[model samples]
Target: MLRRRGRLPAAPWLVAVTLSALLLAAARPAVGAAAWCIARSGASEKALQSALDYACGPAGGADCAPIQASGLCYLPNTLAAHASYAFNSIFQRSRAAPGACDFAGTATVTLTDPSQLWIMHLPFISKHCRAIRNTRLSILHSELHV
Candidate 1:
């Protein structure tokens, strides 16, 4: 006689997926994992726009390709949003220097991962975002200066 096997129930699978997502959401940054960027609040629109131009252009020395129109970070287009991306790129590339994120008093550093808010919606770029954050954190821990 042959025996038949039953398939697992969908409820359990759903529960497991939910739990996994929660765990990932709660994941903490590695020790000394901090990053800096321009703050979207408290700055005048004109100042933010000027800073964005400088950051994406020459002064800040960051690649603003991703924040350009038709780019992954271009959605919900706003001066502050685009500026934040550009400022973060400069901050990460400049090794989080003391003033790299300042943008003339418009920026600040935070322990929380900015990518969590910025790139979370981009499934294709999520992994790349984590990689960039992780690399920056690791570099931050190793490099005593800045």
Candidate 2:
């Protein structure tokens, strides 16, 4: 007769997998929630300024705390900068709903995360790229040999 192996308890493993999934979901940005600012090339300067004013004012319904003096996002202190913050705040708070990012043609919604652009522009991005390339090469080499 063949010997049978005993089974281990599954509760702990199930809990661990559930926790990992929740953490991963929390770490990622909300789907379709990415925000775009009006301060881009070819946008009308006057319209952008007006949109910023409204976004920061009570009419726009955005929390302007971060853009205030001495606030975390207060630096740069330009109209476009402040407006971008306000517009993004509103867009996120609204759960990225349809028309949430449309600031009277001053702004548009984008699927790409805006923070990724900042990260790419950082001085250390090249180092990160090299590391990723090296990792990919290692994986490819191993796969080919296998």
The number of the candidate with the highest TM-score is 1
lDDT (tens digit, per residue) of candidate 1 on 1-146: 34346644677779989999889866743455676565557888888888878888876677877666656556547676677777888888877766677887776666655556654333212456456557877898889665
Span of 10 residues, lowest total lDDT, candidate 2:
119-128
Candidate 2 structure lDDT:
0.63
Count of clashing pairs, candidate 2: 0
Highest lDDT against the true fold, candidate? 1
TM-score per model over all chains: 0.57, 0.52
**Candidate 2 lDDT tens digits, 1-146:** 44346643577668988999999998765765544543443557798878877877788887777567755456556665666667777777777767777777777655554546663221112244346547877999999999
RMSD of each: 15.3, 18.6
- Give the residue spans of candidate 2 off by over 4 A: 1-40, 119-146
Each prediction's Cα lDDT score?
0.67, 0.63
CA lDDT for candidate 1: 0.67
Instruction: Pick out the ten consecutive residues of candidate 1 with the lowest summed lDDT.
Output: 118-127
